[model samples]
Target chain A: MVQEDYILEAEKLYVSYNEIDIVRNVNFRIRKGEFLGIVGESGSGKTTLLRALMMLKRKNNDIKGNVRFQGRELIGLDEESLRRLRGMEISMIPQNAVTAMDGTKTISSLFHETICMHRDGKIRRRDSDKLASQIMEKMRLEDTGRILKAYPFELSGGMCQRVMIAAAMINNPKLMLGDEPTSALDVTSQLQVIQELELLKSNYQVSMIMISHNLGVISRIADTIAIMYGGRFVEYGSHEDIIRHAVHPYTKALLAAVPDADGKISKGLPGLPPTFEKEMKGCPFASRCEYCIPRCRKELPEDVAISLTHRVQCFRTKELQDDIA
Target chain B: MTLLKVENLTKRFKKNGETVTAVNEISFSVEAGECLGIVGESGCGKSTAANLISRLQREDEGNIFFEGRKINGGFRLKPVGRELQMIFQNPQDSFDPRDTVLQGIMQGALSYKVYSNRELKEKALDLFSYVGLKPEYQNKKTSELSGGECQRAAVARALICEPKLLICDEATSALDVLVQAQLIDLLKKLKNDKKMAMIFITHDLPLAAAFCDRIAVMHKGRIIEIGEARKVLKSPEQEETKKLIQAVLPVR
Candidate 1:
């Protein structure tokens, strides 16, 4: 595909906090209406990378790279331009619903504010209530009247999240960024939320970048997967490639650690990710990798393409694939 | 034999001049060395049942028998708290932020005969290793430990009194996958070695399938279905159970 085909693209993006690189040179592209899943352990810089792409970084961090949205340069864009791009063009759904929405405000008022922000007085105050209820009905929320009147704390966690998702879609953005959107919910509620997201993707044709720590969630939702470790994308490939034929040790270990639905427990990976307080050299996963060679500890590996879409950053990825085959 | 029996467990909370039933007439028994998982969504009353059984919250109507003896008021006092321990969803909340790991764990045995400082420290050290932590962690403050370490410390604290029944109220939900697996392994070891009965309350179906011998599916303050874990997951009769099973993203 040509570069113009991708709606969003990040090239050599790096984010540093107090001179410590949290997100290393990472690159990816999201084609129109495509869902890309980013999976990693906590502190793997998945959230940081997402924030950087959206230009939502806190003041303390220094971001270095290029982000293109709809063939336009996004990085180093002025705040006014970035603000115009956010929400109306690129929306976000946060992890915790209870904390994401204001507890003091009712769901209806929250929707009114969001709609008014993007609509720019085109949608009157009276119409917002009708629009909010219509959106709630679309989101499959029952008793829309009662739900709109209820405060975030008064409603259930699942309900609050559905409302949040509805609020994000009020502006009808082309892209959605969800960071652990369903992690706080129960299984049934999680299923409901996931279904709503899938419906939005299929019916509304909304492209999304979902960040999750759970491999199962990523596998179930994402068409393509990016496995991150420490501060880098160790492997990026199609969902089947990552799930059935992952070459990176971190990705392999992650898949192995998930318990089977048949009630069988897999061996847990030992050790934790290296703390990035100091400058990092060599492979970040070398300390925890089971098949680490001496070279892995001494040098950083380059990204090698197994296929057009499948890329791995490991010195021994070929050997690992050969052994697996 | 049943280590704990809960009969007609019911609890109601009165708020804003309206009474809402949290747990309604739920009955179950836990065999020694067995884990019974109560799987449900947030408002399903699973956590309420755990609280009522552990005597953290008073049940409006219920009979809780610990080894054939009924337990009532002042259950948090000696012998009762020691025999029936509960681990919360956020393990850090259960700990006193100002207390050291040794101090927090030794507090679990306060009901028993007074222990010398050295004896308490020795016991705490033993429990540290028992929950897969280094003995040196006993000296660390609760704030210094990571999420997994705090949870291990919480488990050690719960087991310090050598409880007959352990109630884990979504204890592993806040942990990572690897740490959660390690905690499950430790809990399994404790169940096998000590013959301790556990009530594992959680919202994750696949996790319950892996950890529990039997499962009770709860919905809106009712147990919609209860049976062997594998059987329930394989051929769920109740609509709630089917939905929950379908919701689980199958791992292999």
Candidate 2:
């Protein structure tokens, strides 16, 4: 693909809340029609990174970063401009469906509002209704008319989530940001939602930046994976590279923690991640790293280039590899 | 010997003049020192069955026999609470937030009047070590500890009473992956060391397969299938169980 194919880019991003950094020096790029996965445990700043990319940080939160969409700056843009760009060029599917959608508004009303906000001219209700049915049909949503008439509370969680997806896609944004989209869903429902997302990605050619704690869910959809820890990207690579050869200790620990269906229990990492409030000088994972040396505690490890597509931040990757061999 | 026998257990809740059957005639047995895992999705009634077995809720129709003694047939039962204990999903709110870890565990033993004040304190200290908690956490309030530590405190409280059966109702669901592994290992060790029967209830089939000796698959308030962990997980006979297994991520 050509350089113009890249749709979104984050360069040396630093986001903080009330002078406390929640995401630090992060960098990544998304190509047009490509799916990128950001995986981490809770408090790992995955959500913060997504919010920062969307310029949706809370009041009093300081963001020192550059987020470019189609080679244009998005950080210093005004609310009105951002709002205009949102739902037209970019959209977001928030983590909490219950809170993201209005309980009183019918699914149809929400869809109508979203479509009208992005549409250039005064569109008629019939046109909006037609658009809503089209997107709902693409999402495999059954009983579109009934769903549009009923309130959010009357629908099941799975149906509510599907409606939210429809509402986000009704505007046909180029880029979509999903935060833990299926974390709250059951296994069957999760699979169904994932299938719908896959269908949307292929049929609409929409690029996505998905944030999830479940690596399995990420593995199924993401083309590239970025592992974050303590507000930093400890590893970044293609999904195949990261899953097969994770060089960072934190990434390895996360992979090992996933339970296998063969009934063999792998011992997970021993300690928790470092607290964000505390000042740290060296490696953030040193306290929990089993192979931590004195140098690891004294110097922060730089991002070591393992391959053209794979990179890791770890001092003992080679040593760990030799031991494993 | 069978530690507990549950036969044709059923429970129904009346909500807004409509009857919702939670557990519809599910039957299973637990052998001494065996770990039985009940796997199902939310609202599948596995937790309801756990509550019924612990006697936390009254069953509409069922028979529960503990150590060959019938206890759930409308017979006025004595203090059977000491013999069967339950560990809830959220460990943080399971106990009094103001109480220390030691105080919580000691309260369990003290409320049963099983040990004297001094003996209870001593036993609480010892149980903390068994659950991988340090002696210093004895004084730390429940709110001060992390998720895994709070769960350890909860386990210590449940085990301090020396119950013959421990029912973990999604005890590890709220924990992170690493912390969940530690808790599962700790439970395995405790079951081995104490020779206690356990009912591990969870929705994660992979976790259940790892820790359980036998598995029971439940769907819509029914135990659809039951067999050895490997057998049931490898080739589930019921269609719902098969769909659940298929939905799970394949082991790498």
Candidate 3:
């Protein structure tokens, strides 16, 4: 696809704290209406990467890279200019809904504030409420009247999330960033949330970037899968390329570790996840990788395209692929 | 081979002055060295049932038998808590905030008087290895440990008593997939190697299918369907069972 066709594009993106880069040299491009799923465990810097995309870095961290949204550069944009892009153009659904929304305020007020922020005095409370309920109904949330009146804590975890998703749609954002959107839900509720997201993708021309620890969740939702480990994209490919033909040891190990629907389980990837305490070199997964050699520990491997879209960063990916085949 | 059996077990609580039948006439038997999974949504009385079985909360009605001995307020002989231990969903509440994880584990075993204080420390360390925790983590407080690490320590604490029957009340649900996988592998080992029986309670049917020998689907504080895990997964008898099996996002 051409550069203008991409909804969000990142080049050599780095989010650093105390001169220690947490998210290092990240690069990805999402075309319009495409979903990019980032799979990572906790501390993999997936959240940091998402925050950096919108100039929402923590007070101590500095985001260094080039990120273009609809051909408009995001980095170094003043807070006033960035505000215009955020919420209306680029929306986000946070990990925890209850914490993100005001607990004391009813769901309607939260929606009113969000809608009013982007539209200024051009929009009123009634219009925003109508828009919110319309989106909620589209998401198949019943009892809109009761839901709008209910406090954030009064709603269930899944309901709160659905409300957030609905609220995010009020401004009609081109890009939606979800961080572990359905992780807190039970199985049935999770299914509902996933279905709603799928519906949103089909019904609306919106591109999404969701980072979740659940491979199953990502596999079902995303068009492209990025397997992130130690703050780097260890593997990036189309859903088929990553799922059917996984090459990276971390990706394969991650795929193998979880219990399948049949209840089959692997020995699980051993060792604690890497703690990025200092500036270091080599693969982040080398310590836990079963096929790790001495060279693997000392040298950081660059991304090699095993296929047109499937990229892997591992010294032993070739041998691993051979063994798997 | 019946390890623990519950006959018409019922528990009730007054919520806002309204009586709630948390567990209504539940009956089941767990075999020695068997893992029986109780699957249900939140507030379906799975956790309440676990609490009653472990004697954390007394059942309102029905009988509980541990190794064929009827257990009640005056029950003796087997002493439920020692032989029948439980791991909760959040290990944060399971341990002492001030003490080391090793100290918390030793505390569980110290009451039984089977091991010396010095010997219990060594046993705790051994259990840590089994749970994939490093030896150095023994001194760290529960606050210092990660959620997975705290959970592993909780497993060690439960194992310190060397319980025959372990009731995990959505114990792995709070953890991420990789940690859950590792924890399940460790639990499976304990079940096989020590002939331990477990009552695995979780809302996820697919997860239960992976570990449990028998699966029981619960709805409205009652077991709607109970059968072999394979049978329940392949061909569920009840509508509730079908809903649960259908709800899981297809991975394969």
The DockQ-based CAPRI class assigned to model 2 is medium
True contacts kept of each: 0.53, 0.42, 0.60
* lDDT, residue B14, model 3: 99
Could you give candidate 2's per-residue lDDT for residues B1-252 as a string of tens digits? 999999999999997899999999998899999999999877899999998888777899989989998888553334677778889988888988878888987877676776889988888888888888888888999998888889998888888888899999999877766778788889988888998889999887878989899999999999999999999888889998888877765423
- Model 1, span A1-325: residue lDDT tens: 3878888999898898888899998999998889999988878898998898899878788899888998899877999888878889899999998898887888888988888776666676568889989887887888999988899999888778888998998888988999899888877778788888887887777889999878877888799999988889999999888998888988887786676767677766777777786567789999988888999999999899999999999999889999999
Model 3, A124-197: lDDT tens digits are 77877888889899999999989999999998988899999999888899999998998888888888889999
> Residue B193 in candidate 3 has what lDDT?
89
Decreasing TM-score order of the candidates = 3, 1, 2
Docking class of 3: medium
Model 2: lDDT to the true structure: 0.85
lDDT of 3 by residue, B1-252 (tens): 898889999889998899999999999999999999999986789989988888778878999888898886543434667888888889988887998988988888787788888898888888887888888987888888878888888888888888999999889887878878888888888888898999999988988988899999999899999999988988899888889888876644
Better of 1 and 2 by TM-score: 1
Q: What lDDT tens digits, residue by residue, belong to model 2 across residues A35-81?
A: 99998887889888888888986988888978889888999999988
The DockQ-based order of candidates, best leading, equals 3, 1, 2
TM-score of chain A of each: 0.97, 0.95, 0.97
For each candidate, what is the lDDT?
0.85, 0.85, 0.87
Best by DockQ: 3
Error of 1 at B115 (Å): 2.4
What is the per-residue lDDT of model 1 for residues B40-110, given as tens digits with 9 covering 90 to 100? Answer: 97888999898888787888887988888888555554547788898988878889999998899887775
